[model samples]
Target: MTVVTPVAARVTEGRSLTWRVSLSEAADADMSTMFVVVPATAPGLSTKDVPARWPRDTAGAKPDPERPLSKVDGLYLFVDVPAGRTSADVTLPTLGDRVAEPAEPVRFRQTDMDTGEPLPDGLVLSGSVLDAS
Candidate 1:
């Protein structure tokens, strides 16, 4: 099972969602794995943005220029976490600010990198748009 938690309410704001993520266990399924999913209905968020520094290795290796995070199911952003890594500070790209509306919370799910399995209930990360600009 995987666990996802928001470090703070303000996880930085830009063209996408940038925040730190901690994994109870490393996800070592394959070269390409699905670590998280941000739904389109996640309240004012878009998954069309290009992912930044994706396909990264937690050991400080350069990001894989070939592999990148992309939209799936038309609206969900499937984030890829490196295999064999337990934690990372991740920055996922988005077309618009995740917090398009004030005070509303943006939500995301932690999933098995390879199987696309969501974590158990009550393990999602959520926060408001502290800095939409």
Candidate 2:
């Protein structure tokens, strides 16, 4: 199973939010991609904005540059996970000056990089809420 949690309970304006992605076990060859979906109505949030930092490997060697997070369709962020890794940290940029406090929680999904098919038991709901000040 895959789980995502916010690194901080509250964030400030113009600052990025960090999320920790944890897998119950190491990823297999088929499970290579993970997607984090945020609400589209989030204030001051845009998919075009680049993440403040690169994803950091938490349970292995340095993060794979080829596996950096990329925004998709202006709604979700996806990253390629190295096989045998259990956890990683991803930082997303929050632009503009307006406060962003979405009512809905963030969601997570894992899929095969090549086939683009979701893995069994890959969809997780309500991972965390983004609370920006």
Candidate 3:
């Protein structure tokens, strides 16, 4: 059961947010990769905005513009985790200027790379609310 907790419950627009990923237990040998999902409706957010430390998985990282909004619920940002690490830090890219005040809380959850399913225990207890100044 892995859990991802945002360092801050809220962040100013145009700023980056950091999240802490804690493994309930030591990372499994087969658990080599993970991903975070952000709402597609998030303004100016994209897979290309992810930090370099967490390289995007070319295979599934690309979002289809033609996909229906109903079907496209969120965007995927992939990350590689070294084995046995108990925890890791993920810093999201800066919010774009287009972000509006009182923007929706940016929720995040860790998911399985292959399954594209949220980890059994990787639900986001709280999302980082965006404040436009």
Winner by TM-score: 3
* Position 34, candidate 3: lDDT: 48
Q: What's the lDDT for all of these models? A: 0.44, 0.45, 0.51
State the lDDT of candidate 2 residue by residue for 1-133, as single tens digits.
6776777424443455566777798888534455544332333233222233323322122223322122332233465456888877665554433445553223445555465554566643233234444
lDDT of 1 at 81: 52
Candidate 2 Cα deviation (angstroms), residue 6: 1.7
Please identify model 2 stretches exceeding 4 Å from their true place.
Answer: 34-74, 96-133
Best by lDDT: 3
Worst 10 residues of 1 by lDDT: 66-75
Give a tens-digit lDDT track for model 3, residues 32-110: 4445454434542343233323322333423434232123343444444457777776655544445345544445556
What lDDT is reached at residue 26 by model 3?
Answer: 75
Alpha-carbon lDDT of model 3: 0.51
In the predicted model 1, the residue pairs found to clash are 34-113
- lDDT for model 1, please: 0.44
Ranking by TM-score: 3, 2, 1
Q: Give residue 30's lDDT in candidate 1 (0 to 100).
A: 24
TM-score of each: 0.42, 0.46, 0.56
